[model samples]
Target chain A: MHEAAARNGITARFGLDFPSFALDVDLVLPARGVTAIFGPSGSGKTTVLRCVAGLERATTGFLAYDGQVWQDEARRVFVPTHRRPIGVVFQEASLFQHLSVMGNLKYGMTRAGLSPEQAGLDAIVALLGIEHLLARGTKTLSGGERQRIAIARALLRRPRLLLMDEPLAALDLKRKSEILPYLERLHDELDIPILYVSHAPEEVARLADHLVLMDGGKVIAQGPLSETMGRLDLASRFADDVSVVLPVTIGAHDDDDLTRLDFASGAIVVGRRPEPVGRKLRCRIRARDVSLSLGNHADMSIVNILPATVTALGETPVPGHILVETALSGGERLVARITKRSSTQLGIRPGVPVYAQVKAVALFGE
Target chain B: MLTGDDVQAILLTLRLAATTVALLLLIGTPIAWWLARTKSRLKGPVGALVALPLVLPPTVIGFYMLVAMGPWGPIGKLSSALGLGTLPFTFTGIVIASVVYSMPFVVQPIQNAFEAMGNRPLEVAATLGANPVSAFFTVALPLARPGFVTATILGFAHTVGEFGVVLMVGGNIPGKTRLISVQIYDHVEAMEYANAHWLAGGMLVFSFLVLLALYSRRKDRVDA
Candidate 1:
């Protein structure tokens, strides 16, 4: 229901200036879908999520989202965390350790004013695949499973927005991979906008529809995945960064036991099973795994080759790994880790054309 | 047949213990919660006051109570003014003294439980959309069930065994304020070992069972 017309505008003004840091920068995020704020540790990423959820108020300014005005200091209005229509998943899982999983889920649902029917307990159970876990005590669950339950519990409240602070940060690599698909599902399926904070580049590439790149508590760059990622000069500043995302479609599978991915820029070869037709796939090429060749290669075991233009060449903070920012014809930017010796031997320079011999293409789950 | 005194004493003891527990629950809970959660500068003095009965000579509390509730004391004058007559040496006076003397027994367990439970659960409940008061009932009190059990049993048991305070304040007045402890002491002084033995033995069994229930219930909560 549309609240009184006065309640209709939801613009979250997240600008916080700390003594030696700025926790957040200004932005008006879209009202729907997942908006992942990606940054490294100590970069004030979680502070942004905290400010939006009203767990910690921004030092100054207002939170406006949807048509509802959640916070405005000028109007002397600030909703406390309890009154705010926000659900947060802390990195620690934050499950009610004393209560059974079902009890924990009901703890929020019972207080949300909506009945069980409105929140759809059964539907959320199926959504997160937590039906088997519902009756178990929350403490007994594994890290990955606990995060899934946490997400489910937050979603069950039917929140206006979900703020997750690196919810999978504590999980192991295997657990992280398993939770990724479920998170991807939530991103695509849920109606509420999610402000997910993570420093994981691959995660940002796969799950985020909009990326707010933060560094030192400032919004350094932000836009749709492809548009902002092209600022190869901007992304080059992050030290020892790996993997550059390439948005490509499954062209077809190869007989030599590999999946052929056709990017608008160039085709890539990866070892993955058959995927359904026409679905977009994010092929992750680790910067270190990709080596540059001045000319086309003939004897290499590497299966995929692409003609990439040298966009920016700079020495990485960590020596030996030269940061190569290259662009595909489709305008998708890819960061590669090539050795300086190869840079000099190939006479590599900015604006020079080269072949990106991708050693492996890790296809993200659809 | 046995004399009427023993039966009357038993009835009086139960009435005293029950009333004492009710009164303690009313006053002790808020104080326990405060001791558990407060960061105020008043904590040290309040804590020392609550635990005074555990170490202070019972006769000291009794002596002060007697002086404070005498006909000329403030409370005694006020009650007499309201037409209640003298309060000390009465059943109501014994109940009041028992509550004061057994406060530590009721408050310690509740305070420990609240401290161990911490503020996280309450904060989580707040973020879940429940107000503070509702969160206390739904989250905090339920989790502190073992503390409540311990407080109730200890307070009741301690009140049942009260002697010095009742002797000083209630003055061994039968059918009005005489409790089991005073009755047992009277039987022994009169060399009626049979009456004293039965009364003392009954109290021993009652106290043992109360402790067994407390320990076992605490174990169950720990396991849960």
Candidate 2:
């Protein structure tokens, strides 16, 4: 029964020593959602991803996914990369130069021994919006298009886990936005859990359900995205990226071309409505964009104001800044960064009621 | 002007060159692959040994081969023990000498090609579920086609042009070890100038055409 109780998702533990760096980490990741391993360059983010994919052999490792042991260094049971049922997307869209897009996709499907009916290459192409590129040469694709093809190729393998190493790091701003929707569709439709390695907080914020914060070749923090980002102790680390990810349902479009997004507490207005009413969305409001007031200020220039109670307060790395955690009317959480001088002047503390004037809300999809 | 002896020598030369090229390819691919991928300290020494024949005089190799393949030598002793006679002054003697004389010609091009391939394509193949052996044959070999062409031409041409090594090892046995280059030498020694001109002219044109074809095919592949 104890061994049967261990039947869960992926658990990866790795200890790798290089001449210039060493990485040691142990993590238990969810089996169904995207888990982001976020860190700066050389923070061992990609190294961890490679280890899970069996690409890099760690000195000491124990990796198991859904009760199957992929690696156990002590036992000398190491599954080679080719034998592991996983797919990887590198920073560069490393397509086979000799193969067209269709050829590349078919290569994965064939190698994985998945038939067209099983892998559904046609459905995947439709999902990634790569139907037009099937016959085209890989060399002819733009950076974003190539990356989309790469993602589709990886997905067509029907991998148990997908390891993506900074898939959008090589794209420009315009190209990133161009490929984001396809990624969102993948995160929505595919059952394959993804281990996404990235240095960009925005990418992590947009895509991740679970967050693993890495530093100095080790994991410093890991938890649900909303809770991890709102933690007072971790606020200083994510100082510039302190934002609440509020899941809201689209209510109605106002006459002034504003979309009404309703959460547990209240509705917030954003720029022109995107998806139709009733579609769920996530809105990210940065702490700095939020200003606190004792009561409602109707004459303020800010468009959105919601009542909240002070839950906690913490210091930021910047000397004059203080980050405030507040519970909205329906127990939803929000954070605001104000000056320490104002914190004392306003007598802001836990259990005190306040009004938060939000400057902008960046709406992302479910 | 071409006599029956001339025809025999030409046929023998073609046969020797073909056999040498085939053997070199079979033995050189793995050696070149190892040299390209190895990080061992012995790589430099082994590479120098393979390239030794490139810079050394053909007669020097021929002298060594003659001494090494004679009845009293180690290889000759082993061959006789195996029930085969000594290798010197025979067709196999010239063939063996030509393989040694053209080792670098077959190895260097393939080695350079493998090195230029880097590690990405093979890594990609591995991620696509190909083992190392399959990756080498499917991805690495196909991508290194131009190198194979260059190696084949160089190995064949160098074997056909072998004279001093063939003479030293085979003792100029007519229709047995007398290759095109050795036959030309004999014609010159016997004052048969016109026959020498025909064989020599044919070889010159043939080498040029082989090189031309290799370059064109390489360029076409690059363009494609």
Candidate 3:
């Protein structure tokens, strides 16, 4: 499996210079699944996507995806954007205003010489919930609706890769929630690799499988999303939102306004979730929400008390705080931020047994 | 009460205007698109050359065209060498002169339209598997309909009303080089006030209608 994955991965190296900006990136992105380029504005995230899409040619670059060479500045070999098999979802949708939704969708299909059945137009329309909007003019649609049609249009081309550059940045909160489930459905069902660019932590946490964290036109860290998010050393870069991601399966729905989720080590109870039993979900455990105790306190209001062993401890950015990395019995890792005074009082050190009282678990739909 | 000469001149003017606009659409589109999208150092110089006619006096343009189309001029020598003979006083000579004189009228509006359409739509089209040529036809041209309409109207009207350039390059031959503007000059020179008034009144109404149509269409586009 490892050999097969390495053989099929995408390798990209780009270097560009402008009067006010410079971008330099070298990435070996997964050829399948969603890999997010997470960064702040002006950090060159979108520029990287544009380079991959061939919309903006890098001054010096090389890109080879799954044995196909898309660009090589050294060889003077560059495929024009139109000939590249890729679909792009811009931030504003960028639908052709003169065309109806159906016309816009057909634009790609005709250009690719693919019939409706071959392009899976019916399935895509149903998947994106845009069947009712076939004949509607694009200018008349709302922001969320326009984005859905844009996504459907891109998919109709049956591109080998899909690039989404901050696709949700233009929408309001309600619109964002309305569109996110469709995006998740696309991610689950589609076979094409997706390079999603965004600066929103919540959006990245909810959807990304692999993470590429960037700052000031440089990549700070990159790895699997769960492992990267759990690093205590990088906690300061994310401000106070550092946390660990737990892959959980829905265990049971109780009558006491709670649902049980089974993780590696133990079961966690959270507020009621509508997902059915046995459904897989991701839960985020914020470090600040956990409290360390030397022994299980029966008088505490927190219901979660799982046995854990101190694995490592590091100083936090705050003057009087410390970050603790602990391993549960099942070898699952959890991080907690505690006051330095509390750590001294509890005599917390590596190999010492403790109980972690988890105050919250943020459940995400599968 | 139109005479045969008046009718001939009117038909000739219509044909000339139609031909001039058709040629402008063909020749000016690429120039306009290039001006809109190029950042090269030559853009300023080329743009100034295209706009030179807008500020120059038509009589001066007429004088230069007259000299260039003369029997010994370079264009005349080339055409003569090709067995096409000299261009002066011919219908084709007036057509060539009109094309140069009315160039900016046709190019500027189309250039503005292309500039107003930012790079997003074309980029989207490219990612959807359209080459640059196909993207221009499929996306750029459809969005630039208003600009084309303006160019056609302006190019046609400016060619119709031109007097100095036509008189200089085309030596007022009836049924051949005798355009409506030249015919009006004939009526006035002969002191035929009644004929002059008839042709002049017709031109007045036609120019007003063309401008009225342009402005009303522009308003509709804005509201849409």
Q: Model 3 over residues B1-224: C-alpha lDDT tens digits?
A: 57799999998888888898999999999999999999999999999999998999888998888888777888888888898888878889889889999999999999999999988999999999999999999999988888999999999999999988888888798877899888988999999989998999999999999999999999998898
Writing each residue's lDDT as its tens digit, candidate 1 over A112-199 gives 9767789988888887888898779976788888888888878778887888889888998999988898887887678788888988
Can you write out model 3's per-residue Cα lDDT over A1-366, one digit (the tens) per residue? 322333586788889999889898888888778899988899999999999999989999988778788888999989999988889999999999878899999999899999999999999999999988998998778899999999999999999899999999999999999999999888889998999999887887788888898777777888888777778777776656667888899999999989999988999898889899999998888788887999888998888888999999976677788889999988888888899999999999999999998998777765
- Candidate 2 lDDT, A182-298, residue by residue in tens: 888888988888899998878888898999999888999999888887777887667688888888999998899988899899989888786999999878888888889997978
Top candidate on lDDT is 3
Q: How close is candidate 1 to the true structure, as a TM-score?
A: 0.85
lDDT of 3 at A203: 81
Give TM-score values for chain A, per-prediction: 0.87, 0.95, 0.94
lDDT of model 2, residue A147: 92
User: C-alpha displacement of A37 in model 2, angstroms?
Assistant: 1.0
Q: What fraction of correct interface contacts does each candidate retain?
A: 0.52, 0.50, 0.90
Which residue pairs in candidate 3 have backbone atoms (N, alpha carbon, C) closer than 3 angstroms, thus clashing?
none
lDDT of 2 by residue, B1-224 (tens): 78888899989999999999999999999999999999999999999999999899989999999888888988789889998899998999888889999999999999999999887778777777888998888788987777888999999988888888888899778888888888888899999999999999998999899888888888887787
Decreasing TM-score order of the candidates: 3, 2, 1
DockQ of 1: 0.46
TM match of model 3 to true structure: 0.95
